[model samples]
Target chain A: MQILIIAAIICLALSFFADRGKTIAGIKRGGVMLLRILPALLLVVFLVSIFIYLVPEKVITGYLGSNSGAMGIVAAALIGSVSLIPGFVAFPLAGILISKGVSYTVVAVFITSLMMVGTLTLPLEIKYFGRKAAIMRNVLSFFGAIIIGLLMGVFF
Target chain B: MWKILDNFFLLLRETIFFLPLMFLLIGLFDVWVPREKIERHIGYGSGLAGMFWVILLAVAQPGPLYGAFPVAYILYTKGASVRNIFIYLGAFSCMAIPMYAFEIGFLGVKFWFLRLIFSLLVFVSIGFIMERFVGEDFRVREGR
Candidate 1:
């Protein structure tokens, strides 16, 4: 995140040097863009927060840790799709689950779906990509997560 | 309510920090980068090369999934193919470099490498399938 800030600042400075008017115009466009998306962005944050509260890590670990068949993989994928856990937290939790005898395939589904799919962010995605593109991306990623999980089952 | 507020604030803090800078950079991209250059690299005609270029670009980008949206919109407007945009979003969502190091630490280098390969394959294929549905004419929904 810090790196991103530095990069943006550096680029902003360079762009300013190259063309002050365009740089200012770019910043204004950015502000307008943020305003345009603010409502949907807020809705996403609200939904995600409520979701995190409702589906605690304990509940997720319970479902994903013990069960080890098709049911478990489905559960993992579902939890992953709906929930928004940061990678810093999710990866370590996944490692713990693996240590507790959870299958790599199920963990794979959880991780893949968690990263690739986003239910809470749908409104924002639709705002940008439109309904068809947004919906297709999530749907495709959902299925892709399952397939990748199965492949992990075979290899690991 | 307090728990919700706490969580909301945490999420908001992160969003507030990233969105402005991301949007600014994307806005600058909008002004600076020419349409022909974007089209030459990732437009309908770019094909397999476009997919590879987007994947490389996505990995280098570091931010939350939401950060990718504005850039994707700009790219779409600039004539990047729907397939390349999808690949860019998918790769950005999962293949970020900072996340890569941590994933390897937890899941082992083998798992990291395999997942990376598998994800690229899956997302790229999905991108192809989506482009078939969405087509080159798809326009990103503009401001509400």
Candidate 2:
């Protein structure tokens, strides 16, 4: 934490010395970007909080909780692939699910796949990477997410 | 109001603690470097240099695949090769300049380093395969 603060301060100081005008401009621009993103992030967090409060841990566990077996892993991965929750929300939620008895493998697969594979974002990916490239990357990432789950199963 | 205040404070705490330095670097890049320079230097085609440039951009950019997906779509539609796309996504998934700086701050250097290495490996491996097998016809259709 101290290191990060020091780094930010140093970066800020360097920007001040190097080019105050540009530095100020960059900070201002970055601030604007943050503003644009923050609302969505907050809304998601708020909704998830409500979900955590309302949804029974047992229900989540039954579907995706730890004891869920091979089918559970597949279910968790599929849920993650489609869900667009940000990492901030995903991590805490995973913790909650785990406490409720969801397997570590299921949670790990869900989070890894959530970050890596994106069936929901496929159109955009295709637009950028081309159909073949986008498809292949997602397919690979999908499998990769599973591998990560299996690895966690063995180690954790 | 108290709850709102608490949430805001929590968010502020997270931001202060975890925001990556990479973000600042990205800000610097945006402010100091010209977009044309990025494109001219890293613009599509096959080869090691192109791949390197793609990785640089991916690492530098922050945000989820959604943001990059559109850009990638645009680039591919315009004729960016499969190799470049692989590089872009690879970089995007792995590197996040601002967020990473924050992460290192909050999570520690070790975690950040591991993530960096892991993401790079995943991206590079994926790029290699796409370049090797994916055909060009799949390139983004022009202007659509």
Candidate 3:
């Protein structure tokens, strides 16, 4: 926490030096941007948290738990692709799944895909990188995530 | 209606807690970090140096993948190397300085180290593969 504070302070100081008279205005502008986006980001987080709290592990495990086989992998990947959970929440969720007897492979797939592939963000990616590159990257990442899961299965 | 109201309040709370700091960081980057400097470091046709520059950019960047990934895609189409693509993805995943700070705080130093190592390995490997096989044509139809 202290380190975070320090890092922020350093960034602020650097900005001051780098921008001269603009630093203060820049920060104020940033604050305004935050004000605009914070509501949406927070709302999403809260909804996800609610889902985490309210949904039983068994329910999720039943659908994509390790024992579900190929279907499980597909289910896990799909879930991961859609869900935009933060890393902070993702780790604990993985722990919960493990405790609930979800397969480590499925969990690995889920987490890997969650971090790498973003179905929800596809349009933005396409707009930014072009359709071909965006699609290719996501497809490759999807496969790569599965490969990682398989490797985890073999090793762990 | 009640559930919706409650959700709204919850989201408000989270935003109030986290967004201020994030916005400040973004603001700082916008104000201080010159576009020319970033371009020189990671711009089109920059090659390996550009890749390093992007990694540095990612290290300093804040926010979720939803926003970052698209920007990366744009950069790639605009002429960033596959290596730089890898660096962008890798840095975005685990190396953002703020993210690193958070990871250290929550998961400890060892976890952060492992994550950094793993992320770099994965990204570099992907980059090498893309460069070797995909070449420059990896992007969608050129000339928009």
- What is the per-residue lDDT of model 1 for residues A40-137, given as tens digits with 9 covering 90 to 100? 66776777678667877566556665454788899889999998876655665576567557778899899999989999998999988888888989
Between candidates 1 and 3, the TM-score winner? 1
Top candidate on lDDT is 1
- The TM-score of predicted model 2 comes to 0.72
Q: Candidate 2 recovers what fraction of true contacts?
A: 0.28
| Poorly placed runs, candidate 2 (over 4 Å) | A55-76, A86-112, A124-133, A148-156, B1-29, B32-35, B43-45, B69-81, B105-108
lDDT by residue (tens digit), candidate 2, A19-67: 9999988777766665565677566556654565567667777777656
Best by DockQ: 1
| 10 residues in a row with least lDDT, candidate 1 chain B | B35-44
* Fraction of the reference Cα-Cα interface contacts (below 8 Å) that each candidate reproduces: 0.66, 0.28, 0.34
Lowest summed lDDT across 10 adjacent residues in model 2 chain B is found at B14-23
Error of 2 at B9 (Å): 7.5
Report the C-alpha lDDT of model 3 over A80-135, residue by residue, as the tens digit: 88888766456445544655677767877787688778888888767655676667
Score residue A45 of candidate 3 by CA lDDT: 53
For model 2, what is the error of residue A57's alpha carbon versus the real structure, in angstroms, after optimal superposition? 6.7
Against the true structure, candidate 1 reaches a TM-score of: 0.65
For every prediction, compared with the true complex, DockQ reads 0.37, 0.34, 0.33
